[model samples]
Target: MPRVIGIDIPDKKRLEIALTYIYGIGRSVSNDIIARLKLNPGMRAHELTQDDIAKINTLLQNEYVVEGDLRRQVQNNIKRLVSIHAYRGSRHRAGLPVRGQRTRTNSRTRKGKRRTIANKKK
Candidate 1:
């Protein structure tokens, strides 16, 4: 495993694919990074030289928000929404679907497991 920006990327995977193991980077971003660094997209991660890794680290730190920073930024955004009492924040607070999905039937993913109620005796 090669460590990129404190995240360990699989050495067996292609450079482009391995880059996606980092938190904020997806396929397109990985491609962009590879292009900017003039690295071969098809090259395995383990093939990277120390200089290449240094270049990647410099580019990421200079231009991109990733890993811990990205996570913290996202959490801050959610916290802001909750502080403002937004509807989405309320849904998040309640652990329900944030989007306007019909909760009457579906949305078990957000709503979690069902708790059945017992019948009242006479």
Candidate 2:
């Protein structure tokens, strides 16, 4: 494993793919970082030199919100929405789909297991 910004990226993967292991970095961001830093995307993470790792660390720290910082920022956004009583926030608070998915029948994943209601016989 190679450590990048305190996160251990898999050593066997290509540098571009391995970079995605870091929080807030995805395939596109990884490609963009490699392109911007002029690093070889095909190189394995384990093959990175000390200087290359240093450059990546520096670049991420200076230009990106990642890892704990990114997590905190997202949490803060959710909290802000909830505090403001937004519709999305209410959905989140109710543990339901936040993106307007119909919950009448197909939202079992979000609404959890069905509870049977017993009917009284006349």
Candidate 3:
């Protein structure tokens, strides 16, 4: 495993794919990073030289919000929305889907396990 920005990336995977293990970096962004740094995307993560690692770290720190910072930024945005009492924010606060997803049947992921209501005997 190779450590990048404090995250351990799988050494057996190609550099391009391995880079995506880091938060906020997907395939496209990983490819772009490889291209900008002139790195061999086909090379395994373990093959990265110290200079390459340094360049990657510098580029990520200067040009991108990632990892802990990205997570914190997202949380802050949600908090702001909640403070303003936005509709979407209310959904988030309620632990429901926020993207207009139907909750009638398909939102078990957000709604959790079903709670049964017992019948009352007269």
Candidate 4:
């Protein structure tokens, strides 16, 4: 495992993919970072060296908000929506999908397990 941006990336994953394990970084951002740092995207996570980590950190600081800062910014955006009573906010508050996905039968993953009524005995 190699630690970068406070994340421990698995050695088997490609460097670009492993980079996505950090919050606020996705495939696109990982590609951008690798390009900026002149890193080989095909490299394995375990092959990353100290200077690579430093280069990544520098690139992120210059061009992106990441990890804790990004999380807080997203949380604040949701909080603001809730404060203003938006429909999306209400949906979020109710723990339902905010974008109107059908929930009648498919939201169990988010809504958790359903309870059942007991059968009567003779």
Clashes of each: 0, 0, 0, 0
* Candidate 4 clashes between residue pairs 3 or more apart in a chain or in different chains: none
Instruction: Look at candidate 2 and tell me the lDDT of residue 2.
Output: 72
Single out the weakest 10-residue window by summed lDDT for candidate 1: 113-122
As for candidate 1, its clashing pairs are none
Off by over 4 Å in 3: 118-122
User: Tens-digit lDDT track for model 2 on 10-118?
Assistant: 9999999999999999999999999998999999999999999999999999999999999999999999989999999999888899999999879988888777666
Candidate 3 lDDT over residue span 1-122, tens digit each:
77889999999999999999999999999999999999999999999988999899999999999999999999999999999999999999999999999999889999888876663333
**Please, what is the whole-model Cα lDDT of each candidate in the order they appear?**
0.91, 0.92, 0.93, 0.85
Q: RMSD for all candidates, in order, please.
A: 3.3, 3.8, 3.1, 3.9
At residue 104, give the lDDT of candidate 1.
94
Worst window of 10 by summed lDDT in candidate 2: 113-122
lDDT of 1 by residue, 32-99 (tens): 99999899999999999989998999999989999999999999999999999999999899888888
TM-score of 1: 0.91
Q: Highest TM-score: which candidate?
A: 3
- Each model's TM-score? 0.91, 0.88, 0.93, 0.87
